[model samples]
Target: MNIEPTILDAVNKWLTPAFDAKTQEEVNELMTTAPKELEDSFYKDLEFGTGGMRGVMGVGDNRINKYTLGKNTQGLSNYLHEVFPNQEIKVVIAYDCRHNSDTLAKIVADVFSANGIKVYLFSELRPTPELSFALKHLKCQCGIVLTASHNPPEYNGYKVYWQDGGQIVPPEDAAIINAIEKLNYDQIKFAAQDNLIEYINTEIDNAFIKSSIENASFNTPQSAKDELEIVFTSLHGTSIKSIPAVLETAGYKNVHIVPEQAEPNGDFPTVKSPNPEEPEALTMALALAEKTNADIVVGTDPDCDRLGVAVRNNDGKMILLNGNQTMVLMTSFLLKEWKKAGKLNGKQFVGSTIVSTPMIMELASSYGVECKVGLTGFKWIAKMIKDFPELEFIGGGEESFGFMVGDAVRDKDAVAATLLICEVAAQAKAKGSSVYQELQQLYVENGFYKEYLVSLTKKGMEGLQEINQMMVDLRENPMKEINGQRVIMVEDYQSSTALNLLTQEVSDLTFPKSNVLIYYTEDGSKICARPSGTEPKIKFYISVNAAIENVSEITEAEAFLDQKIASIISEMQLK
Candidate 1:
């Protein structure tokens, strides 16, 4: 294999004495046996995206390894020092059930300790949200979590969070990236300062559980909680203890666990992918739910930051609800409960992503609450919470099965979401209704909205180019129509501009610049295109809605919307 000079230089750097012996041996083996793999791994440094870095675990510059994590921690340490020069810097660290996650978490803590930063490291694996909560609870300047949320087994990630209990965003993200890029392998401090590292566990768990219960409690009837049968699966990750604990503490008595997936296993042997958004991942839990005649089936991703649920429909058949459906349920339920409890003042608000269904905004409007739209990730939602400290952040969610209740933890949290979702189910049951029935009622109250997401995975160097070309083509030649409907407006997030086709007037977008495009149709259809920041894929989110005068018409409306989405996909040649 003919290696490029740049790739060879990177490969040679790993072979030097600065790297460990095992990493050196792995690199040598790859050079001799798998030159293509070596090239792919050494071609470039692992990019630190807005939420930090995620990549395949291996022994190369582009891979997530001890060295890469070390360098990132050191850079973060430097930035913390620069920002808070006189104060004694402190950071909390957590890991999930991913391969080498525990080891990597230790390495991260070591590097931070070496930089003279006090480290509060979890004694065992925990959910990602707990890390965010610990950061703020402990009053630490920053925090880190080592787990690639729902990625494949071979992948792992490092996420950095600010004191605000949200993932790093904007100026801080750029600054951290710059600091990471300036460091060399030799500059990373690998030695640990044991005295500065403190192991913490039970104390934080108690506080987090207390906070979750307090935030989610809406005086849910105890009889309803007792009658609700909940089947929960952690998907072989960190939510094993916390999710069940929160439910039980909230007075839920009939909760069952999927035994096969209850334990933390990095391989995620039970599912193809640990992502709860995928239907297949919830198969085991669904089966268990059927056996137990459970009222609802819930599953969380590997990091416990996202949640997916399946509820029994009117036909007594279990059906999985998509991200939008769950968000609608949670948002609408929270708003209603708050109003019922006399908590809905003009100062309360909620948030969702641009790709999420517009029904949330309508629901918020009906309740006289403000609904803010962010770019995509939950970090943007958290940023909105931070930006508007005067207003009460009721709750927020994205179309990725991620929802956060209240402000206990700024990031998307499955623990609180799972508990609150069960509460919603309980109350519905008490009212002689089911979760699915309540969802249909929601559609009847606030026009039916159906959302679908299609992701095209583009792997390796060539695939990256193809993805970029696709975006360029869309931007250069905007579509005038889709599914025979005229494109009334086009919003280019990268350019921070929105164009109204009829009036040909352009308006500036206030959100941060991102590589995303949204097309609005004259018939109330919306399409969003954006590349995943954390994965090797481009995603298209389609949402179509119609007024539902009767709850019985939901099926017909859903079918019509599905066909509309299909036609749009076909017209755009996305198939």
Candidate 2:
């Protein structure tokens, strides 16, 4: 393989004595046997995007290694010192079950401690949301979690959280990235100050569990909780540390955990992908639910930031609810509860992402609560809470198998979400109705909306170029029709403008600039395309809606929407 001059310079730099002997040996071996891998790894530096940083673990400037993560930590420490001048800088650190997460967490702690910053490190693996809670609970200026979220086993990452208990956003993210870029590998502080580093466990765990139960509970009768049969799986992730305990403490007596997946393992042996959004990840949980005749099943990804759920349908079959379906059920139920308690005083709001189902807007409008939409990632939802503190945040989620109950934890908390979802199911069972039945009734009342997501993975340097080119083509060409439906509006987030197809008029959209495009059709169908910031993939989200006045029409409405989505995919040559 032919390598670029710049890439060859990077490779030679790694071969120098500046990198340790083992890293030098590893790079030399790759240069001899795997020239392509060597070129790919040195083509560009890993970017610290707006959503933190994630990449495969290997020896490269583009990979997640000690040098990369250490640089991030060192830069973060400097930024915190500058921001809180003359103050004692304190930062918390947490890690999940992914390979080397523990070691990575310690290295990060070492950097902070070595730089004269106080550090609070978790003694063992913990949920990502708990890290968010701990940062705020300890009054730390910043926090970090070492986990790749739901990505493949080969990947790992670092996510930085601020004092607001949310991921870094906007100006801070830019500032931190700038600091990281201005430094070299030798500037990272790897030495540790034992006195400045503290290992924390039970104190934060108890407080987090208590807050979870309090936020998730809705005054459901204890009798209903006792009757609700529950099945939960952590997918060999971190939620096993707290979810089951929280459920048991909250009056839930009949919780059945999948024994095979109860243990935390980084390999994620039982599933191809540890993500809860995949049906195969929940296969064992579903089987257990069937065997126990459970009312609901829940599964969490490796980081426990998101969740997947399955409920009993009317025909006695276990139906897996997609992320949007679960979001609808959770949001609508919360809105109803708030109304029942006369808490809908127009000073509250719900949150969602642009790629999520429009049903959230409908539900929020019907309840007279404002629906705030942002770009993808829960960080933006967290930003909503901080940017508008005057308005109370009830609850919010996106169509990615994640939800947050209340504002205690700025990020998504599957542990709290698990208990809240079960409460919904338990109450439905108490009223002689099931969650599926309530969902169908919701469709009957406020139109039926179906959402579908398609992600195409493109790996390596060449693949990244291909993904970017595809986005450029879509942005410039602008599809005029799909499945015989007329495209009426084109919203380009990169340009922060909306163009009307028929009138040829342009207007500004109130959204942050990004490489995302949305096409709206006359039939109320919305299609969105955006590339993954942290992964080598591009995602397309499709949403179609139609009115349904009776429960019996659900089956037909769903089939029609499914057909429509399929046709749109084919017409757009997505396959």
Candidate 2 error regions (>4 Å): none
**Judged by lDDT against the true structure, how good is candidate 2?**
0.92
Question: What is the lDDT of every predicted structure here?
Answer: 0.92, 0.92
TM agreement with the true structure for every prediction: 0.99, 0.99
Off by over 4 Å in 1: none
Candidate 2: residue 366 lDDT (0-100)? 90
Write candidate 2's Cα lDDT for 1-575 as tens digits: 78789999888888776678999899999989999888878889988654578888889899899888998998888898899999999999999999999999999999999999999999999999999999999999999999999989988999999999999988899899988888888888888998999999999999999999998899999999989999999999999999999999999999999999989998999999998899999999999998999999999999999999999999999989998888889998899999999988999999999999999898899989999999988999999999999999999999989899899999988989999999999999999999999999888877899999999999998899999999899888988988899999999999999999989999999987888899999999999999998888889999999899998888898899999999989888787
